[model samples]
Target: MGRVPVGELSRYLLAGRLSTNGCLTSFRRTPRSRLVGPAPPTLRPLRTFHAAKEQPDPTHQQVQTPPTVPLRKKLKDEAKQARKQGKKKSNADSQTVEGWELTVGIEIHAQLNTPCKLFSSATTSFNDDPNSHVALFDVAMPGSQPIFQTGTLIPALRAALSLNCDIQPVSRFDRKHYFWWDQPSGYQITQYYQPFAKNGHITLLARDGIAPEDGKSVTIGIKQVQMEQDTAKTLAHNDNTQWLDFNRVGAPLIEIITEPELHHPRTAAVLVRKIQLLLSTVDACVSGMETGGLRADVNVSVRRTDDPSQTLGTRTEIKNLSTIKAVEDAIIAERDRQIRELDAGRQISSETRGWSIGSTETRRLRGKEGEVDYRYMPDPDIAPLVIGSDLIAHLKQSLPVTPDTELDKLISYFGLTPKDALSLINIDNGARVEYFYRVLYSVQDMIAADDLDGEGADVKTYAALVGNWTLHELGRLTSSKAGPHGTVDLTFAPDGDCAQVPDAELSQLLYHLYRKHITGKVAKELLMALYLGELEDGVRSAIDTHDLWFKEYSLEEYEALVDEVLEGEDKVLQEFATSAKFPQGKLMFLLGKMMRAGQTERIDPANAEKVIRTRIESLRPSAA
Candidate 1:
């Protein structure tokens, strides 16, 4: 009888070659091991919180009786049953608030925007044919070795720097073992004991779009920013059999772990959004949660709000929450569930859960996997990665400003209000932010060139106006729902609803407003025409072609227009007059009717508003 190594038994077992009779089954090279040496008694010490656990040898395993409930396949059957019979349909069991404080910590896995797999030359592509991008190492072929990718480090470091993390001088990879079809290697290579970077903090300020009114700062401590390879994705829930897609396998990933400081679900959501922006800003990762390029795992627990000790409760993790909305909803549901259970004198179990889109609640995935369950061990093949000071400095110097910094700069430098600043920076669809700056500078350049013609218009006022028009006029057209999704550099769109907002055309439109040539209403018309791809003739030409230039209306014309509006909307005018105080809303409503009755180009909004108020006051006294 030949001795079978306990550590290598899983490989043979998975291959259906291992028998209780105990004949040694082996390979020429055991999965990339350069030399196949005699098997040792054990791989290493497996640590447990309670005691050191012994590794089980397959030959000495005891056969136990089967359980009552049948498991055709552990993953498949459970998911099938769950989908067949939905859980917890009672709306009457609504979440009861027991004053239990919720604590949430999140682990975000963002796929780094790299050209190739982390340790293989296989190129990365989304929604590609299955196994199309796979390398020998990705499929865990025997004798295949991991070739360390230097390209991944640039983006990894960029991610770390964006989060204000301290880079570790040296870091090593570890193996997290789990026997699953998705991970054919049986062990995922990751950074565990020593990660790439750590001790980072992302401060969420009011301007960071988290707490706009609270005026308080929330600093989320990043425990670790580790570079890891993603596992192959498995599609099992909707189908009877498991389907493995290896395209995503061995893709570069950066796992960012945050300390459990977040209490509110909305803040947790904002934090995720902030991190998403940061990663994208630094060119580290493509932050598309819907596309599975980015995903989050929230570790949530509830504690007594009034408790003096402030001890954390037993936590259950909600895994792979794809959207920020899902992250918040899952945390809220989980916290509520725990509160309800505690109120009923039931213990909250620590486990891994999944978010059900249909039920809109957290469902149990499995028992919580502890550190011992993972059986982490350092990779023997890969050497420890060392980051030189020069490399760190080089990447640091090139790091772009994160979203929050850019937000502040827009407010302070461009004189944009926080509301307007947020609107510009957080446009989901296009490069409207860049479009804004381009138009701003173009108008400013025109002002600089023709100082006498632009006497009344200052650069700061132009900046404010530019921000306004970009958000309202420009952004209204080039929205996420409507595209010319701003794919090309300066050219946003060729011709569509969200056509290209060429700086020259937009700047000329603004210049007309600055030069007192057109009212805002007329300018908006021209802006819409630009959206219709009519700006090819130029803003100046369109204004000339349509006779859309501004004209001054006399006091009599304003009064006549006001009187015509009053006669048509007499009921609304009566409503305004009957109000105890001056109804500014009603006054504006009437003013809008008068302007739309046809004289937007001649009637300035400010003068028109003044005339309407005075006329309304006169009418009120006469009616009295």
Candidate 2:
């Protein structure tokens, strides 16, 4: 066979299944040394697994490499040592409240963007039908063993690194015993004893989407990040009957736990938003929380600031908050509830609660579960997840630029305002920023090739022009008509190309503006025409065709008028060409005559001189 269709292959084969001691071992991309038998010659390119049981099982290669140290570990150690050796001062933000201090933590459950579930080969898509993507292992059928998908491990590692978490060289999964409608298995497979990554931090800045007046520049410490499976969603009907959607069952998830350091609800909201942006930027997690890609458990407790006691108050957790706003509101509600309870001389109780729509009140779901409630044990089917230090180092060097990196480039290199740069960085998953850069560089190249004859273009000043057009003008045009996803047509072609504005047409518009061939008003008119199927030709010809060119003369018109002035000054042209550099005084004198002849004072004196120089060079012969 020449080639095999991907759909034709069974998911078991795609999952890299092997028979070892009558159980399934799911791993792929091995280093080729552990193969017990030679690979089939015909399907060597496809995934090949060994059935004989001599080699160890893992997520990938299991080299004898030590775990990579998290960057925050050293900083945490130093901070601890300093606090132990010296007196500690109360952190202002953490202990801000007078006579009352509210402490909060968050556990965010973000789904990894894997095509399939972690243990099963079932696709991880949201389907309406119950059990649409469930497999035997996902449903906990007897004698069904799980094979770990390597696709799940890479993104988790990337997210860990991005958040400054250390990767454990050897991480294993555990089983937490529970009985619920969602979990068909009595126990859930999770990482309890050894988390994948730990000891990370995410910093919230005062600007770039956050409020400047708040003046926040605090780093919230990350306690741990673990990998686990999601339970089925319990959907209830109008008749009091409920159905379990196993389509969402057994999906891969990363639980990011934060230290109880947040004191403000706004700050907690900002932290969740920051994590969403970071993980999505690195291609780790899906960005939208409303679509169930991510959710959070907001935990809060209130303690008396007047009391210097080491013991804190009872904390309550609001579970499965699907929106960032919900996280903020829930924390605020819980904190206020605790404070009120304390004011009435009542003790706060620990419980898990759910938030309602637009209300500051929370409904209790259950009492908080401790270790004894869910009997935690090691998962027998899956083996330890082994990762090599070499792979970690390579991935570190290959990490893509985050939003902060792009923001700095726009502000420092392009001289854009922070607000303007952030506007670009914060939209359409960075497509707006990408589009702006494309338009700018394309215009720069166009002008360099057309105007400078491949010489030094040096169009840094035009960046402001590009910024204004991209941020204000393009945005205005795109929002004029609402299309799919509440988007107006971007490409201005009425016949067809009425979707996104292509970078080339935008480059052409900017080029015309840069050369002053068309005024700002004319360019805006041309853009509207381009959007509305009014412009007949390209930006260059459209200006003249629509009688929209400004009073300023074109380069050709300026050169033609300069030729008339140079006709009477033959000796001037000869001396100007013979000299190593043209004299400034003589050039200005000639430029004045050229402007007078053209009857236009709108042209730049520098541009007028350029016309004169070119005309003079052409008049004189090229020397050998």
- The true-versus-predicted C-alpha distance at residue 262 of model 1, in Å, is 1.3
Q: Each prediction's Cα lDDT score?
A: 0.78, 0.75
Superposition TM-score, candidate 1 onto the true structure: 0.73
Weakest ten-residue segment in model 1 by summed lDDT = 40-49
- What digit string (tens of lDDT, one per residue) describes model 1 on residues 1-624? 566677456434333233334433233224456455655332211112246665666798654533323223555788888976986534223222456677889999999989999999999867788888999999999999998899989999999988889999999999999988888799999999999899999988866555332247888999999988898877775658888899989999999999998877777888998788788677788556867789999999987878769879999999998887787678778988888888899998889999966456688999998999999999998999999999999988998766777887888888999888876765542256777877888888877887766564546778998888877765555455445643332234312122356677888999889767898778877876776776677989988888988887888999888878878676877776687777888887887887898566687888888888887787675643
Clashing pairs in 1: none
What is the alpha-carbon lDDT for the whole of candidate 2? 0.75
Model 1 residue 36 CA deviation (Å) reads 99
What tens digits encode model 2's per-residue C-alpha lDDT throughout 245-337? Answer: 888888999999999988777778878887887887788986558678989998899888766775778889998898878887777677767
Model 1 CA lDDT for position 481: 44
**How does candidate 2 fare on TM-score?**
0.68
Per-prediction TM-score? 0.73, 0.68
Per candidate, the number of residue pairs that clash is 0, 4
